[model samples]
Target: MSSIIYTLPEGFTTGTDDTLIYFYTNDRPSEKNKVVFTKNMLCLLQNGIKVVHTANGKEIVTNEEVLMLASGSILMSEQTVANKYEAILIFFGNKTLSDFCAKRRLSFNEKSPSKSIFKVPQDSFLKNFCLSLKLLKEQGNSEMNEVKIQEVLNYISTTSPDIFNRFVGQALAGKSDIKIKQVVGLNLHNGLTTEELAFLCDMSVSTFKRHFAALYNMPPQKYFLQQKMDQAKLLLSLQKRPSEIYAELGYENLSAFSNEFKKHFGLSPKQFQTENGPGEKAFGLPEQQFFKDVPATL
Candidate 1:
């Protein structure tokens, strides 16, 4: 079952369990920045982009988006983001999602919520699903995917992806004491230059260097390059947008993407994105890969 929670920064006021949390970051602009295209993320648009490098980023997705974490080895984020948002939300973790995928014939689209925003087309099942979240919350096992929860989640899979993503977001938000560290890659995944990293996070270069070593035992540039390369490989395998992959990983030019790709795997970004095998560009997707912690009870 899914229960909704609201996340707020310190000093923010809120209401009951049914209260909706505000998500927009004040500094995040609605401006359309340069878009990048690479291998997984090809058809989405992201908001709140602050480019630390060149003005023109990759042209990966086509619309402004709210990205969601879907799958993979990423365990950094506290919540998974999905593109193509909608009004309703549906979520079932680890077991529920896995079991349903195993038993049903469904394919999660690579598109963001901005694309189609799920469509339920029916309601008989919707009523039951809402009840499930409410009941779970009331019983305080809102995190668990009991047989009842699974039934509701799976039944609602036919509803809309938006509803599913919302449920997941809401459930995660509801938890008390969610640590900011739960977000995996704030500065970790995409390593930055000492100065660049310091600037983005609002710290001095000296402080940034010290913290970088304390966290990863290396300089920011090295960490950034490694993540850039790692993402390059995943972009190839997941078929994510080549250009966006470059920007997300901190590259400023196709040359940078190409050079890094070669340094890591002897292949250029273009060649890798075109490759149709694992460790190469296979499918493109948005939202940085991160493992949103799912309650063990679920």
Candidate 2:
């Protein structure tokens, strides 16, 4: 998927499955990876800490914390020393949520987090439930794995109504309000298609473009390109080679990347590097102050 930042191992459920479990362990610490949550996700950081940055504020999730990320894009910065970093992630979509509510005859009408991300208050049962999920996964028992998902849901519904509502409440509320600022700010560095971005914002492509232009006074594509160019200039200033940064900017080939850079700054990538070198000002539009003032909450 366009949103995948890391290729998780095979024990996790497929997208089509009603429930999913993700187990991640890395012996070598990796550079921070940005990812877009394609579905509503529940994450339990079992070991090591994770720092998540969004258009809003940054959140630090530790083993004692449980994080709930709405269906949206987010920049995840992972950190670990010599020790292995591990986490258990669970994903449930609208369909699975609908089935759960219908079967339990429960109500989920509360308003959800105004921002796309939030930390859920820890529950003792929830922690234990996560441990059981790990056990099921280790056994490779697909059937038991699904049951563990339901068990956690049932626990939340019965013992912790507030947490349950916060977890799936907004998702059950149906489509969210499409705020131009939130959508654009969150996806500035993201490599999502216009159509995918529209879907996340709960708007048709035409509507998204119309609203975007009205808000920013320029077409979305133009704004996106400008942002990318600004980032490229910053990377060049840091002495990063064009080859290393091109793919990160979503370009497929060096030739195309150079052409775009030349068009934007009147210099090819190599020529710009040769003149500006490292630690020198690379030519491009000055950083936009608007990004600095992005709202601290979504």
Candidate 3:
């Protein structure tokens, strides 16, 4: 499937660098769009059906529910209602959250389940709060936008303590290594650039490169290429024709796939398949067997 990368805050022209509040609207339907959220986000959907796909599972959101998302990569699809889709997005970083909690002396339930995303039922207070944000946006009062975001967080803390604790816990958890693994594993076949991957992992390109090398024992590009080549070989061993599997492996065409396969394995896909018949071992063991031992980080 084709994918689009959306890097928020930088993608929009509203609000400050660290924290932003914007009224988001769309006139059409969008599906499977990859969003790299650099900051924690609170989304109040006024109209539309939003399907969010993450490592945990799929979540369907609507006007009756609000979505609280931590900084990460997620596949999102939105279907418009009445020819329009609308939501108010508030983006803030961990520092903003920490400051809000410290200023209020808010204590989280450490035992609460940490989740990267949350869907909470919208209440009257939240609805009114969203209305206020829309008014402020129209008034060009950027200063109050941050306060309004904090106000929503405070409201959630008091009204929905369980969800607030879980959301906050995940936001401040700081599990960088686990996050790197998840981001890399999920987007391996999605044709994303290293810069985009770094953005998804919420790290600078330099930091991501360093961490990637430490974890994978190789450069990111080389590791990705190796993995893709391995997959191509596995597909070939399964009796799948080169033309049938090249697109599945993200190659632009059969020629590109064959060229890379030859460079990596010293044989074209057809030549490899002929040399090692279907269902026979190619790498001294069954290709399926190799996948069984693949580590979670992969």
Candidate 4:
């Protein structure tokens, strides 16, 4: 299924750097919605179930738990039990987490796995904390939002040390190279724009381009086009028709894909296919075998 891209905080009615406390309520249930978190987030589900699908697996959160998600992409589905879904979403940046750790002198095990999502069980204290945030949002006391978020971080660190440490480690481990790799690998076949990819990686477009070049030795647009052309050639050699593979390669239509294929290989896809015939093995080996030797970073 085609996925919708959303960058939180930017999509909200707040500035990018501001820590936003948002009361989210919906009357409808949604399934498999793709969400790319540009900032670290804490989601306290009050009256619904949230299933987050990540590379590792799916995590389910309900009223009994809070979800702490690192900046990344996930397929999320929300279900309401009483014809309404509700949650409190808190968005903060890496700097906020770093400053919080510094102020508290918090130390975590370096060997802890840097997980993308942490499910924190909701207790009486957390339920009360959620209530306080909802009240603050209703009272329009946005000035204290950051302070309140920090207070919750402090509470988590004190009460659930392991989860807190893993969350912190995940935030700390989100380096430029790692984040770029993750975003690109997940979206390689999706044909997302540069700005969208940058947003997903939580970086500015220029910064994303710079890091992308360092890793791939070419600009992102060029690298992506080359990869698509290479894959198209392999598919055509396997007897897949141009019309059948264009959409799968992220092209909108046959004409656009054909034009690009010609530009890259100096021959239209049909002409190339006619000359090479089926099962010709374009890269000297089967497609699966050829991809096995490719670098993991790509």
Best by lDDT: 4
The TM-score, computed over Cα atoms with residue i paired to residue i, of candidate 2 is: 0.50
Candidate 2, superposed: residue stretches over 4 Å from native: 1-15, 30-32, 110-112, 121-124, 175-298
Q: Score residue 287 of candidate 3 by CA lDDT.
A: 68
Candidate 1: residue 201 Cα off by (Å): 5.0
TM-scores, each model vs. reference:
0.30, 0.50, 0.56, 0.57
Better TM-score candidate (1, 2): 2
Could you report the Cα RMSD, in angstroms, for every candidate shown? 20.5, 20.0, 20.9, 20.4
lDDT of every model, 2 decimals: 0.40, 0.69, 0.81, 0.82
The residue-by-residue lDDT of candidate 3 on 1-298, one tens digit each, is: 3466998867896545778887889999998898898899988999988999988889899999989998888899999999999998888987677656655656554443535679788989888888888788788888897678878888888888888878877776753554566677777777788999999978999999998897679999998898898788777877789999888877888898899989988988899999879788746677678668654433
Model 1, 1-298: lDDT tens per residue? 1132222212233322211222222332223322221101001122323211122222222123222222211111111134222122232233334334334533343233332112233354544544555566567673453565456446555545556654333323322111111211454444445576556646677865675565456765666666556656655566566766666666676676778678777777667656555443223433233213211210
Stretches off by above 4 angstroms in model 1 are 1-184, 187-192, 199-203, 241-244, 273-298
Ranking by TM-score: 4, 3, 2, 1
CA RMSD (A), model 4 = 20.4
- Global fold similarity of model 1 (TM-score): 0.30
| Clash counts for all predictions | 62, 0, 0, 0
Model 3, residue 142: distance off in Å is 1.7
